[model samples]
Target: MGLAERRKVMGYSQERFAAVVGVDRTTVGRWDRGETTPEAIHRPKMAEALQLGLAELDALLTPPPADFPECTASPPCDRHGSEGIDDMIRREFLRIMVVAGSLTTLAPDDADAIAEAVDRGSAEDFRLMNGHLWQVYQLARSKSSVNTVVKDQLGALNEALKESSRAGGLYEVAGDLFQLSGELSFDGNRYTDAAASYALAAEASSHARAYDLWACALVRHAYVDVYERRYTEAAETLDVARRVAKRGNSALSTRYWVASVQAEVYAGLQDLGACEKALGEAQRVADLATPVHPGGWLRFDGSRLAEERGARYVQLGRLDLAEETLRRALETKTLSRGQSFRRRGAVLVDLAAVGAKRHDAEQVVTYGGEALRLAKKTGSGYIARRLQALQGDLRTCRRNRRVVELNAEINAL
Candidate 1:
């Protein structure tokens, strides 16, 4: 029997059932209509309310569709011919984009193929494709321009959840995609949207039993609080995230990431001792030889610790420590090689802020100028925001011609 039928057999009205399950009536309605499934946290409560065992509840919640086909061929049979498949995928992509409130032009054929793979390809194929999309998003000059494609892919992933036989894998992928959506929103300064996405990602990851993914979602959520200067709230969130990460795979860098972000939050709170302790914990990630980062979703490999430490020191008003650490960060191969413009730009801006604090016009002009160029070239609002923060310190050197010119350039941005 289906969920609705089973609920009726148990003599519970939808309203009473929702009350028992601790959810809204519409959530129960959505479950009955197959619009959404019960989250993992709700499943046990639902089963107890319906007088069903865990396995029986799962079966009722996810009944196999009557028309699902069995593939007898050596290779999986394509229900839609190859040519028809492309057209169908394109239409689906466009429809999803419209539904997502985006009016983007069609993505190229390669991107279309990636979207199609999310629907019909193997689990590994989905992982690889999603990773590639993330790499593209990171390296792209215009981060906001990548949002449309990310939204489209998210739509495709939601559709895939409906028909996918591999429930665990699909849920994990959904978690990753939702986190990516949160990142895009965060980059655009949409804190509310970003928080919602991160919450959904945590739910999806819980359903998939992906411990690391769930912890990562919580960390991202804490970032929204951190950005708004709610240090205590962010610290509370990070405390939970740290616990969750501890339960994740030891081979993964999840716990270390939690430590890293916790350090940032501690710095925001101006607790230098707590910040230093957290940074020490985060540094252990560098020793882990095999960090598991599936699809590049959890890419914290301790490579950014120097810059992160520097930024934290800057926030704590330790200019002497900040300068030394930030200068070390700038000399790191990653920044010196020019492989990541965003990373290099952020470090440069921090150094300029240090110079501005000391009322050193030449040092401020030198570093701030390059950072501005990178912000313009990369269309990185993250860099632009950092530069704006630095601008407040530049007021001390307003009489200097170079400082005035730099301020004008930043104002133009």
Candidate 2:
């Protein structure tokens, strides 16, 4: 049996098996595909996990001979001298999306990549994979869980950047990848790391002249400031993002997403009129026609705007409005559930905050308890952070047993 088949027989899924070896699951995938080998450190554990002797494991790692090369020659060509990526390149790039991270080290391939231009086809390959990684990142419970694979993919793209004869497409890929790195950092509350990654993403997208991507990167950078309660600083950043998005595709929701975030910062600064005005601009997204928001890199389809609006109201101390709006948002089917629980959990936390404002112990326990469960279920640091912020509010009802238990749980996270 081959390595993949042997792994299945041992009842270890790729994720489980990778965890055993202390590596990203994609590394196990590359090993199964014969595109790479297990490092010395991983082999012994691989053998043990796969129920193989060291000798047998070594044999298993040698994949059966194939009719084609494991990886294609770069600056690709067919026998007829037609230029483009082959089926192998397409497949390889699918796996490559999760492989990259920060562009800290220059790979050895830089010299070779700079020798010939990477075509639009190759750039598209990276784009497709980059989009997939965003989907994976959104669905992942612990956002940090994606950190390793993203770093590895960035390394791969670092070489791709060198190989590019046409720089535009590759630069866009760089923007996309760096934003993902920023997202992982942001999700983990590593604001310093997030700032650095977002700055790189902004630079790359600006180089590609991709207004939406560039604007989004700036918006994300501003979020770090918002989290730190540096409302004025965040507003300055958003002002720039707003102008950039104006130059973006009119068909996109980029401007509206920027407006949505701007509303948050305005609420933070206690500027009710400005906050409401920004929110009205955000509401305009529901009117756009055709060329819908791309689910991967730009998922702001206005689906979560209601929840966002409600949360902003909470920030503005509009308790009555916040409670009503948040409850309505929860009733709607738009809030993602199942493994997609981040937004929903935030809504619950908001409702709990409203209850805490009223010193309503039952309401606090009801909403806070559900939010806590979602945080634990998803291993989501974002939800945990929101719940942590609510800890002070929960103290008003501390005499209640459920509130006390909830406080302890949030503290544990």
Candidate 3:
């Protein structure tokens, strides 16, 4: 059965389910009528609220004409797994050194060390190291771990990109590196850096003729602009990404991911109509059930519906809805083990944000503290900025000493 049917079967009334899921009853109704669909991040929550397993929920969410050319054959996994362990480890160490330097305002030599490490690492190793660095950058920025280190990592990423010209055998590897670079910059609240990396990734994707990668890269780049309140720029980026995704097999998971992100951008702009349009498009692209596509890294099917949808609502100032949707999203299986800590921290921040909006100081203090604790574990700029934003919300709790302390702690970060 479809989402609405599933909810109904679970004995959830439209209003009740909307409350439980943190969305308007109308939005819930839209899902039932097939007029709208949840974003990928929200799928886990929807599955939980409806009491379905991931596999079954995914099947229900799949769009029709359920086959695509890409699904006709499996993409080869020819890239060697751990083909460059030594390089990866060395580069990782250097990246750590660079981040340490950046935070402590240490001498430029440490930053240089990170660059040298990247220069020596293999493409796969660099990519792997880049992933870890991205997380480190986020955590460090949130906790003010070390500016020098963060800068050093950024420098290392840049050096790696420069060394690896966007070409054959190295193009995908380089693209992955560039994407991670953008993610790091974005998480670090360095919008300009994020934009530059994403642009480079898009170029590499074009060279490799990988539409999904190109689209996802650009979409992420747009996210920084969206956060900066540059809605026009964000929308423009997504417009290009959407077109690029269409050029490939839209049924591919990345295409839907693009749609989901675009939906959030639309919501951020307060363009509810456009938001729904993108959401519908995402749902349509996600209809395919074929599992023949490649499935490591960058494999985002419409699997986290509640989180994505709820996040958009949160952006739209629909706090009541945001709470329900975000809470429901929390029910989804935690994101990948390595990544769950950061993602869950973000959701907690969102949940705390809703509480802050409601002037619920106790809830804010409770959730915000947990979020801060979790944020300390990762080096994500996104989480840092989120905590930063909530500082203003805590002003209402001036009378609440604990709330005042929480705000101070977050500010300290």
Give the whole-model CA lDDT for all candidates, comma-separated.
Answer: 0.78, 0.78, 0.65
Which regions of candidate 1 deviate over 4 angstroms? 1-123, 164-167
* Model 2 poorest ten-residue lDDT run: 98-107
Task: Write candidate 3's Cα lDDT for 1-413 as tens digits.
Answer: 67777787899999998887665576577667764455444567777888889788878866565342333435533232433322332344345324332433433334323223333454555456555654554444343343333343344444444443222333454555567655655655667766776776776666556777777778888878877778888888888987887887645777777778888888978998888777887776456776614443365666666677777777788888889988887767665344466667778888887887788888898889988876666655566788887777777777889988887878777
Please count the clashing residue pairs in each candidate, in the order shown: 0, 15, 39
Candidate 3 residues lying further than 4 Å off, grouped into runs, are 1-166, 284-286, 290-297, 335-339
Which segments of candidate 2 are over 4 A away from where they belong? Answer: 1-117, 336-339
lDDT of candidate 2 over 252-318, digit per residue (tens) = 9999999999999999989999999999999899999855587666778787888898999999889
**Predicted candidate 1 versus true structure: per-residue lDDT over 1-413, tens digit per residue:** 79999899999899999999986686688789875667556899999999989998888877585663788977776665543433343344334323322211232334222234444454464566578678877887887776545654554454545444334366567677778777777776668877877887787677666889999999999999987789999999999999988889988899999999999999999999999999999999977876455545688888899999999998999999999999999998889998988899989999998988889998999999999999988888778877877888999899999999999999887
lDDT agreement of model 1 with the native: 0.78
Ranking by TM-score: 2, 1, 3
Error of 3 at 215 (Å): 1.3
When superposed on Cα atoms, how far off is each prediction in RMSD? 18.6, 13.4, 22.9
Relative to the true structure, candidate 1 reaches a TM of 0.69
